[model samples]
Target chain A: MGKVKIKKKETRIDMTAMSDVTVLLLTFFMLTSTFLQKEPVTVITPPSVSEEKVPDSNLLSILVSPEGKVFLEVLGSKDSTMKSETVRADLLKNMVAEYKKTHPSANLAFTNKEMETFSKLNAFGVPITKMKEWLNLEPDLRDKFLESEQNPGIPINMNEDPNNPNEFQMWVRAAYNSMNPELQESMVKGRGIAIKADQTTPYSVVNVVMDNLQTMKMNKFTLMTALKTSED
Target chain B: MAIKSKSRQKKFDTRIDFTPMVDMNMLLITFFMLCTTMIKSQTLQIALPTNEKVEKEQQNKVKQSEAVTIIIDGKIDEKTGLSNPEDGMLYYYEGMPETDRLAQGESNMEQVEFGDKDGLYPAIRGILMKKNEEVVKRIADLKKEWKEMKFSKDEEKNDSIYQEKAKAIRNDSTLKRPVVIIKATPNASYAHVVSVLDEMQINNISRYQIDRINDVDSAMMIMVKAKNEKK
Candidate 1:
């Protein structure tokens, strides 16, 4: 049987132009786009109404990787650590201490639980209980202990603490005795903290963190936020 | 007349020309693409503690007593909400992941306030644990300083170490509940922050705040509790 070779002449699809266009598009996106792949923390921060323009470099960056590990910029680009609390604490303590000498009345302290008066605590905006935990140290006879402190407090000796788990009143007495005079003379002058949170972070995280910071007599505070990106 | 009209009649073409529609579509697409590249969104959530505005007088006194500064940085969500160190409910203390959140610290009679029941805490145990470690380290440092100082020295000098230690104890700044600074990225999640606060319960430290960097300076957001009512 003879075959009818009807349409082989005009259907030669020259995909050269298409291939060139694809390559061009790929290159364009790659060059013009910023893929922050190094971000390891995975969070969904709420929206903010702040409008601050911050520089990318020359600033201390506390990166929250998608996996939730903090990638701290301790000194500079040369030395950064993630998922290491020891390193972070060391660097932060040292830096803050240095900052404190120059700025004595700096709000650089975190708040404590149960201020010996307040009974409740909140995490984020929610109320998470730590009071019972604090009370655990107080024996069942808390009333008796309070009475003892009122009757005749323990001597201000190093070995006698009033805030210890077993003997809180005694630990409190010793803790007071351990105070340094010069710092006390200054009356714990004013200080502050600089916080930089990520965009995808949640509201509760900031709230709880704020609660922690309130303890150190660092009452004054300023919040930082990035200007929102425009959809225009 | 009818036969002559046949030559004058016009014939219409039925093929649709999509050139104008295509042009309009391309223009709209280009406009959207270009405009979208102009700015990016800053999606971050913040939960300021709900409390009666503090009196100016107390605020001033608190400001004057700038002893230790603490900061907590993290995000919040359903999972990482409400960190009660006093709560006994399993759900109440269940914090988010431990990577984020913080708690309170300590201070002196003059430097400290009586209540912060409205204060927040670590939702995650990990952050709280780290905070405890830092506080212990600070105490150790104070001990070392105490050891280094001469107890039998001149009055002014001998009293200095004691003063410093008293300040440290009074100005307890731990992340869990001592003096510590926290800087959370906005990208961190709610669960992450809550887990950190949960640790505050595990550790007995208290008093802290969330650190904020406003412009060229450092700032903070805090939780304040109502003063105890004298019944």
Candidate 2:
């Protein structure tokens, strides 16, 4: 081979198109993202063939762990007249009144700041006695408290008496009463209260929750389940 | 004059690097991926009777000929203390067991495997179809009529007609729909009970109750389990 001089070429590659594509993807994700609510205990709901989607708003979700611990999450209505903040404030007020009726000495009063914080929360399950302390904690400390094993769930005893109900039943009743009349009507028409439970939870645990709801005269409710895959 | 001309002729590079911008975008994408929940869960709607004591007269209202009872049991390993879904079993019977097969010294318990290749659903569906044959046929006819009326644009006329037909089908005294009573053992997982409830929905069953497992049912379950283990 003869010795020949080779031409020099620059190796610079254009990344303008790649950057544009990435920007588009980032914007799409950012716009559509709804952050996952931090649950005290994670549960894998059972799979079923039902196709009805859980309503995005005006919902009271009952979360049940495999250990039978229960938590409550209330998603308020998006309409201007029935905002979540107002509903939550009313619910807290009613709950305090109810609590005081049973335990006259217990101080269930919450400051405006605490009520505001409680309104913004996606899920809550601490007993009424500990709720004041829980609400007063710093945000980071509150997360730690909720995730800790010492966090006793809302007190749910197997009390089937419609007259003297458990704390869980009290919360549910408050939630139902705090809604606007229209929303309450819709709830009676089977448009509210969804139960999300772990697949491995025993039937006894679930039955207790159901019985509690029944005692409150909340006969109609929805059960949240994952979509069943074809292979299953 | 020469220095002024040289100053006027100066040029600058206009190209900008985007590596840092791309890195920032990548970080945001990751954040959103971690925080976002993409799939909305599905829901199964159910209505339960109020928690009140049913009187003896009301309890006797349900006819034995039109009743089906399903039992769910869970088997937990003694060593591991863990429940396996495969170990769960469902037993079902038609009518009252005391007067039926139990009187013949054969437990009326029929085994139903959860999610077997040809499983619990098909068998239950067959029984429901046989029991509700007249009502199902009537509902089908009403649906056909409703569809034709819709196509003919008889909106007001179709509405009342459809409602009347639906009420008749629902209240047909001669049509016998088996009342399903579901009983689960203490160890049986919630998923198994949900599966059976889903079957009722699929079969369009209207009358069903989730009741506690009685002592007799528990004894039958134990007997069935013992016999199966021996086999």
Candidate 3:
């Protein structure tokens, strides 16, 4: 009797099809991706059934933490000469002017380099008095300071008199006066400003921001929310 | 042409390994997937009355017969000092509040509980739906027609026509619709406020406005809370 001969088979497999699929997936992700903006505080907006989508550009979004801290983000026209960076720089200049109106003796200024750095940031909320010091810190340290407890966000309170606007109101005015007419027009129609707050935040905390806006005569604004189905 | 007998030729494999290339692409795809935000946030638009004080005669008044006020209040957790959205109270009153009878612990205001996950408060929904019965009935009939594509053969055309008709029915002045005035105390959770606003959309009531909790409202709420707790 002869022993059965064992069969030899090649062990290698082709990966070309796998590679093709992966590359196609990579292309899709790259095309449809919108990078999430970095914020000092993470807030989950309350859910609603309103179907209006937040505008991509020419918006001034206010971020309110549960602790009542506030931050401001600005975006300019999408296809205009007035880009976000340029508008941010102009806003800085206008803020400086606004601060000087109330405190003529306070010494506050930003160098061109500092302004450039500020323009690239996604959100800013430090008090105007400490803006220079905050801007001069290292990027890592600056972010820490912004999230720290000592950070008093944009000096807001219940100020009914528009003649004496609070720091938050001043920032809004500066954004409105920037060289972008589209922003101003939208603000008038009540679509330019958006309030983003945590779902668990107390109404009192949000009321302060709303009252400030109302006093500024910006009676119209939008509230940011996540989508919720009816059955939820 | 002495080719030197085509010196010993060697055959090589034609296929190249693509394992490393696929690995790199998989890594890149993971990075992009994590960095991207696929769902954009939605927005709720609201317009508040101007803060400037208006003259007594210049201020427009709502007819008392068509007014419905809803107040949202929540309890603050002692440990975290944060309001609990799940633990909240809803109070409503039709027409005007009767402060004159407050001394006797009696008022027109009544306390109500929020509905389950239905989004629309069941108790309040019944009241609002009855108040705006004419509009709701007509809108329901139109919605059925819309579902059947009665407006047009084209799907998009039918949808546009349905939307236009629904909007008209909501704004029709001839309908006896209720004016909803929403108020929230300082301790109310923001979620409750938003849910109340969402109800306006669901009920198709277009005359709702958010007003601040005045002193009179606070007093009335205290009375209602005391009355509710006693029961």
Candidate 4:
């Protein structure tokens, strides 16, 4: 029998097609993706059957951590960047005024650049007194400050009086007043306030937040939850 | 002509390696996957009445027969030293529990578990449905009609119809609907309260309020937990 000889073929086949497909996918994801905003604390929202998607804009998100610390995020209407900036600027001004009424000697004033930086932040929860210091920190240091155990959340006492409300209530009112009239109407119609709490957060903590809103006459709000899979 | 062709025929390899490019693409894809959130979160809308003093006239607005109170309380397990989610019991009662029974040192409070193997416990659903059968039936009928018309395709119309139906159910005086008062103990997790509220939404309950647990109610829960521990 003749010795069998097998032809040795080159192992290098074309990977150009694969690269092209992956590049296309990368582009698609990069263009359409919105990066997840870095939160001070991670929370797993409880699963629910409700299908109402959280509104993309004109939303005030109240994030409650498992440890009962509360953080807030305000996303203005998507159509106009100027409107949101204005809202943020006005919110800062109102917050300063409210802070001044409580502490006359404290300087709560911020420069325009500082106000712009604060307006651009995705989430904030530091006390008004420390807000200036928090914002002025280097980006890396700011993250460290937010993540540290020393950062107690904005003071939220049980004060129900509108005139002498808690800091949480003051922020909510400031956001409400600063937003465009249209957004305020939408909020009153139940599309504005969104509470995102950890699944393990105790009921008493949530109760306090709700009671604060109740005192402010913010009766309508939406609870943010993950979609419940059928198997669960 | 043959000599000229031979001289011109100098071949060069045109293949370029794409392994590095593919490697870069994989890295990019991984980055995108890590940074992007694929699922947009769902939202459960809730409306709570303003925190105002209940007037004497307004106190009688909810009929005794159409009232159900659900209390959620958490229990810590001794064996594992952890708060057992299963230990979170839901105590529900129709109308107010009799104080006389409490004075006699007997507890008449009824207890219901959360969801069972299949889903929401049928017994709880039965009680809720029986209490608000008329309104529930109306909501079912409207939902069926909406489905038959394929109104979901028209978002605005569907939303308006849903709003109208919810409003009508809220205002309907002829058909009595159960008014659920949800009370959670301090130890209970917010998830438990949200789950119970989700049930209210699922059962088409229009009138429900989250209230603070009172002293008598707290006493009843403690008694119930003690009884369960023995078992």
lDDT of 3 by residue, A122-231 (tens): 89999998999999999999999999999989899999988888999999999989888999999988899999998789999999999999999898999999998875
Question: Candidate 4 — which residues are off by over 4 angstroms?
Answer: A1-10, A83-86, A229-232, B1-8, B55-59, B76-86, B116-123, B137-172, B226-231
Please provide TM-scores, in order, for all candidate models, with all chains considered together: 0.26, 0.83, 0.94, 0.87
lDDT tens digits, residue span B1-231, model 1? 998889888778554455554455555545445543334323122233222144223223433222233222332344644322222111111111121222331112111221122223323333334545665566556556666665535766766766566556544643333332233334334333333333332343444333433321111132111112221
CA-lDDT, candidates in order: 0.33, 0.78, 0.89, 0.79
Winner on DockQ between 1 and 4 is 4
Relative to the real complex, the DockQ score for model 3 comes to 0.83
Candidate 1 vs candidate 2, TM-score winner = 2
Give the local distance difference test score of model 2: 0.78
Lowest summed lDDT across 10 adjacent residues in model 2 chain A is found at A179-188
What is model 2's DockQ versus the real complex? 0.57
The residue pairs that clash in candidate 4, if any, are none
Interface RMSD of 3: 0.8
For residues A1-232, what per-residue lDDT tens digits would candidate 2 score against the true structure?
9989897885665667778988999999989998898887788887777888988888889998766778888877777788877888888888988877778898667999999999888788899889989999998899888777788788897887878878998898888788566557657866688889887777777888987888788889989888875322
Badly placed stretches (over 4 Å) of model 3 are A1-7, B1-9, B52-60, B117-120
Task: Give the top-scoring candidate (lDDT).
Answer: 3
DockQ of each: 0.05, 0.57, 0.83, 0.62
**Candidate 4 TM-score versus the reference:** 0.87
Candidate 1 vs candidate 3, DockQ winner: 3
Look at candidate 4 and tell me the lDDT of residue A20: 92
